[model samples]
Target: MTPETSETTQAPEGHAPSHRADGRRFRWNKVPEITVYFWVIKVLCTTVGETAADLLNEKLGMGLTGVSLLMSALLVAVLVAQFRTRAYRPGVYWLAVALISVVGTLISDNLTDNLGVPLETSTIVFAIGLAVVFAAWYRTERTLSIHHVDTRRRETFYWLAVLFTFALGTAAGDLVAERLDLGYWISAGLFALAIAAVAVAHFALGLNAVWTFWIAYILTRPLGASMGDYLSQPTADGGLGLGTVVTSVLFLAVILGLVIFLAVTRRDVIEQDRITPQVAR
Candidate 1:
């Protein structure tokens, strides 16, 4: 039987061994290995999420609440499939990311538009939420490295952290762009610079790996969102006049092509051995 069938059989008996003797051997679909393709497709997914959200809300006359509900439902479905997979599946992984990106943005947007929460307040809220997730994750797991995610609990923390990062990034980016009036292109440039600085600090300054990873992760959302806004907004709004549909379609095409390549190559698959941490006997 396939691993999936075996897992289902074991689940009812509470005997499914998702991990090995190593501390790292646990039943969990691990996060994908970091690669150039990972970052490339992540940015593409983020851009698609932003433009797609806007397109559905504006072009389809769905309104913020309607589009948010639609995206949230889709996110739930993608996440369910992601959780069910026994291994890292690139298509499922990226699909989850793209859907979460939309949901995260919508969360912040709803707070601002419907609840009258200021950008500053939303930013602070999301930052605190992210901090709480990190604290809980570290308290339970002893480590927050994405590479170490190999258990159901750790994977739960991982996705929660991801959701918060996207939400936090959305709030922070909007604060800089709208409240601070940086404009879309300028906001994108600022986030790009910030991400570059984080990379330098991590590679050259001996920064903590987990810290660097989360910092970069949060920054990518804003960078991608800004790029999306810059491309999709009307020329009067200082954008390229591409419109959300065109911009979303462009990024979605890239995401789909890259996901297909990763599926065929299995380049992003997380090997079981890599996450199995050695334990003292």
Candidate 2:
């Protein structure tokens, strides 16, 4: 999930009611508060996703298809655990994100490497898929705010959108970094600049928060992927030669440390405020 602003008390019609009959407002958000820690861990998870996928494909002797199947199964299990929860459990939520990242990478790789699909084609397809998801989500929910992800239906849409973002990011990142021959470092730089632009549009130009958040979230996937490639690919391939094993382990460690900190401190949890009901005279 993308980093989000604080939860708002207002709930659109058809959403889970925010105010109880007693007129008390209760916490309803199912995701973490939008904090710096959230972005840091998200990027780290994306980086790990790229490197770990490569690592598994190399070490496990599993073709892209096999690795994709394994990771997808794992993602399904974690998501089941996630959906079963009434609130966000840091470990379970982040595990699902990390696994989804891997599965997303594998999906793009399978399309390109296994099926001979061009990165450009995959990019277009995933982009269209994501657009359709958003359209459907909004049509059904009347709001796309992450703050409103209190119900299972909204959560389902949220994860579906996230999956498409990762797949699109993988395909687009590859298109620019490899197929277009911009190289990983340059590609990373480009995506970083794009994300910066999105931030400016949101904070300075007053773009919609939800749109900006999703845009930045999608951009980070490629940004992280490029950074991973820059670190993990061979020196001859325009990387620092850290190797996928090292990159994956390094990022995963950082993600683990951050998740532990968040879990312990509860710093990322969304707290609900009590609002007294305004009685009609």
True-structure RMSD, every candidate: 5.0, 6.4
Best by lDDT: 2
Error of 1 at 172 (Å): 0.5
Candidate 2, 1-281: lDDT as tens digits: 21122233454233354655655444356677778998888889899999999999999998899999999999999999998776767899999999999999999999999999999899999999999999988977778877667666778899999999999999988888776788887888899999999999999999999999999989999999989989999999889999999999999989999999998888887654432222111
**Residue 127 lDDT in model 1?**
95
Q: What is the C-alpha lDDT of each candidate?
A: 0.81, 0.84
Error of 2 at 12 (Å): 24
lDDT of model number 2 = 0.84
Worst 10 contiguous positions by lDDT, candidate 2: 272-281
